[model samples]
Target: MPGSGRLVDVVDTTTRDGNQSLWGATGLTANEILAIAPTMEQVGFHALDFTSSTHMSVSVRFHREDPWELIRLMRAAMPRTLLNFITTGMRFIAWQPCDEEVMRLAFRCVVRNGIRRFQFAEPANDPSALRRVARMAREEGVEEIVVGLTYSISPVHTHAYYAERVAALADCPDIDRFYLKDPGGLLTTDAVRELGPHFAATGRTVELHSHCTIGLAPLAYMEGLKVGFDVLHTAVGPAGNGTSQPTAESTLRNLAAEGYEHDLDPEALGRVSTYFRELVREKRLPPGEPREYDAAYYHHQLPGGMVTTTQRMLEEIRRPELFDAVLAEVVRVRAEMGYPILVTPVSQLVAYQATRNVIDSERWLNVSDETVRYFLGHYGDFAAPPDPDVADRVLSLPKVGKLREAEPIGLEGVRARFGRRISDEELLLRLTMPEEQVDAMRAEPAIAERSVPVDAGDRAPLVRLLREIERRRQISYLRVQKGDDLVVWRRAS
Candidate 1:
């Protein structure tokens, strides 16, 4: 079969995996999560793959969670579309005993509330326990249960061990498919070409979850499709974490060009991806790109510190000093952490990079050492600085600068009050400075280069303008046409 003919299901991970941990950033709001759902469905993806219950609830503001609860909100929001969610009792780091009963209840609640597709993984490497969880899910009428094998950050096991787990799935009636979920994006392509077909032929159906952690997921996904794989997961926006998900739209675009037919259309899917990318830039999110821009992506991260938490450890060297040594350390830290040095969450990436870059360069090593210690002490506490606001903007945005968290508020409500006439990026900056100061910043109009500080006046408007430019670029994806005023999703022309 040509590549397109073989591609079938596309599972989206924007909400679950994308939001909870953004690249070089932190978790997204429930509304932020909800905001993307309809677009995801619009992309013709087979499922939404909502995030783990453990990840989502903790990240959401507590109060705004009631009506239109994220899950319920998304379900209701995309009523006609097919979507599924996965909740894990399994901790990625190591196996810990969790109340299987609690896990079951969470599953039941999510399923009853609208989540149809569910995944069950072992807390540790206990494949045996997962079978039991699968059995429970089967009892609950979940037709498709995904069991994870070789997920990143899970107990690292050999291919042989993974084969053994694949064998173990035969015991669970609920398990319709098994996944090789490399969340840390650690899978090697050679392993994929060899193992992907191997798993597909294992007399068991399989799903493949790969990432661009070391930068090979897109090719790996292609290899999976070529080698006989089924559903593959991806994110529609640049807001996705670790490795980007392979979108149905992009893959379908390739398929259409190659004369392949799919259950869904590429043009329709493109419309959604466009909407999603807009959300990223509109919110000052790190932009997602194809292979060429990976290094630039890290260099261009919004808040710089999140990208350089390790570099901060290196002795600050003048330009003449060779950066080879510093770069080497970054690679080492990345390998040790099993993830990239730069992950992108919406607000956090810019804030982190901004903080890191502007931080006194003279104190780089001192800060690096402290950040390294913190990273080591708290490996996955990626969401450490929940929110931080500048001193002057505190009262106006009670929810802005929280280092931890506050009762969650409605992102929809906030946007509604502010007027969507301003983009997410503009809203963030608008909250940061006074109107008069904003105009002054817009007036002087020095571009944001190398993180220089502006007088409150120049600073506010400049921030607004930068974000406005970004939002404009993302919106350009839906280019206007001759007859129609708006660019929209339509059947292939």
Candidate 2:
């Protein structure tokens, strides 16, 4: 109400975070993304949260598609929109920390491909680490560097704590702006009112990227617009509500209702949404739906994806009943480990340890290698001091000594191992992923030219059948005939 006639910027997260949230990061292929890219460009989005190292790894490991090709194709298809790449600051596809040269090269390769905007978050929220990463991306010629002020609910993460972190980066010339990244969707209306001014004080453009895991992000986003945030991260259609960012269509409408204007074409947005909706239906993928408020989510703070992953892991071990126990242990494990913000790597580490505690008879009896490295300072300084007893127990383990003494391989070393003949894009993939996975990706055939069926009418079922038959190597050909209609597809040798 106070900011009537103000214009807001919208960043589309459908391809990246939304895909990860609703479809487990493997939903859209290069063909699917390319099919809808032209229409997405018609909608005036500030940027497309396009890809990340994790998503790239997902492409090779799951779809056997070259991620570089996806970027190049998408860039060509949507030249007007900025493609964004988000990172964890310290690592690439692998969770382990990499040498500075490796990270620098990774950023260079990313910018070289098509990513113009870079957003990074340091799990520990270390200002120095964030500043260094920002400079690295800048040096690599990234157009915009957005540092993330990762949000969490903990005694140590107060408004003053965040303000101090923001102030620490106030003089960072390499950083173009700051984003309040709430991966857990834990931010509330009250929290926004309290924290907005501190972020605004930085005198830099600030954006808000929050998830709707517990049904609070949309409301928080509305309140955030009233605060200092000007740009909001949203997903398109099937990718937007439950675990992902707020939907772009609803966000734009709400913005208008609240006297703010966004420069997105509703018709274009509708087309993009319809494409994804049909894709979801055809693929039988789960669509993001509105979630009821879950008050208990605040205590554990596991992001939506992690929760689903943990459940699957439990089910895999035939211990689905241990879900509640693992979650409860997550709360305990997080506190003992100094309440690191439940984001990537950290969140994963906490969840892993919690699962182990639930499965084993004793807590901390068996620690993961990553957990050992985390406590050994390989992941940067802890946000807060860990429980003294727990730290002693973790540090005393034999694995900690080896993890502390080991050094991550440098870029040249990686090149030597993988051979310098391969392209930087492939080399980066090999450096972070398993050799067999990369090899399989290389051996796989080119993704088919078939597009997702949007308006196929009765032909949709036939398209689905063809895709299924294509997956089976033993099936050489498929022929379908109904009434006077007949179609035959033969697999290429």
Candidate 3:
């Protein structure tokens, strides 16, 4: 009712978050994304939740494509729309924390590559870290900086807790807005009603980014709109729903029903959706579907990606029956470790510990090196004090001293280790990834043309075969014969 006359903005997450959610972040290649770029530009999104540092690393490791080129090409194709880059604020592509100079260089490279909007979250929700990163992004010439108030369900993550964070950030001039990031899809309508006002009171623009993992995001979006959230993050077609964000089509329909206005063109949105739907069918990738409410998901509070990863790990180990038990163990592990918001490294750490607990005879017997680092305060301060017994046991480990003495590799050291003659983009990749992976990426041929195959209906198999032949550059000619029918194609060269 409060948003009756308001024009809501939309951030399209199809390329980044949706891809990660539905396809493990390797769904779209530069060629495929570029083909749809012109259409996406016509959709009137406030920003494209385009890429994160992790996605950039993924591009090099999986697609062997230049991520900087991808960003540059997308910017040229969609000059009117803002391309956003999200990060953890503590690290770049690598999991280990980097020196300030390294982060500064990373930000410089990111902004230089045409990322106008910068969004980041400190895993621990540390206000000081948020402020520091916001300053860094601003200094690097990022036009917009959005801080994520990561949402989680814990005794320590109350309204008061978030309100203090909001208050702390109120004085920061560099931060443009606050994004209520519910990565776990744990935000309910009631939670929005409660937390929305605090963010609104910040006098900064507020955006809502939630997943449809547990079927709560759509409901939460409506409630968020009612409570002064100015922007909603959504995806299109196969990229939306299920574990991804709410579908743009459905969210827009709901917005119209509530008498809210937005700038999105329905025809343009449909075209984008159609492209993705076809792509999903062609690639044989899993399409995002609407999820049913699951109460157990709220208990474990693992993000969508973690749940899938854990299931796959358990199945691989031939212990698929232990899936539910692992989920249960996650709750205890999360509490013992102080209720980290289920995102990136923290979520992975918690899930790893949970799986180990379920598999091993003892709970803390097989702690990961990262877990040891986390408990030692390498990540950031814990939201609350961890279980004293568990913390003591973890701290007493022999490797703690070595981990404590380890320093983040400096930017100068990285450049020296890699070559000084290489470009900053190449240097950044080499800094975080293994040299062999970078070498493999370099060895791969560039994507010079659109690789997405056109749908051929009943003849799709034949078309696929032809496309495969085209990919094998060595094949200059092809012939096919069946019964009395014969078909032949030859390359011009």
List, in order, the clash count of every candidate structure: 29, 0, 0
Residue 89 alpha-carbon offset, candidate 3, angstroms:
0.6
lDDT of 2 by residue, 1-493 (tens): 7559888999999999998877778788777777778889999899999998889999999888888878887888889899999998878989888899888988988888888999988898899999889988888899989999899989999878988998899889998889999988999999998888778888998999999988889889889878899899999988999989999988988887898977899988888887788778878888999998998788999986687778878888999999999999999999999889988878989999999998998999999888988888788878789999998999999778788897875676666788879998898888889999999988976554444523322235666688778778999977888999999899998
Query: How high is the CA lDDT of each candidate model?
Result: 0.48, 0.87, 0.88
Error of 1 at 58 (Å): 4.0
> Which 10 residues in a row give candidate 2 its minimum summed lDDT?
450-459
Residue-level lDDT tens digits of model 3 in 170-248 = 8899999999998889899999998899899889999999999999999999999888789999999999998899999
Candidate number that wins on TM-score, 1 or 3: 3
Candidate 3 minimal-lDDT segment of 10 residues? 450-459
Instruction: Tell me the TM-score of each prediction against the true structure.
Output: 0.57, 0.93, 0.92
Worst 10-residue lDDT window for candidate 1 reads 89-98
Model 1 per-residue lDDT tens digits across residues 190-242: 66776676567555667788655446676676666666677677766463333
- Candidate 3 residue runs with Cα over 4 Å from true position: 315-318, 449-493
The list of candidate 2 runs beyond 4 A from truth reads 447-488, 491-493
Q: After superposition, how far is residue 106 of candidate 2 from its true place, in Å?
A: 0.3
C-alpha positional error of residue 366 in candidate 2 after TM-score superposition, expressed in Å: 1.6
Query: Relative to the unseen true structure, what is the C-alpha lDDT of residue 38 in candidate 1, on a scale of 0 to 100?
Result: 56
Score candidate 1 by TM-score against the native.
0.57
Q: Name the TM-score of candidate 3.
A: 0.92
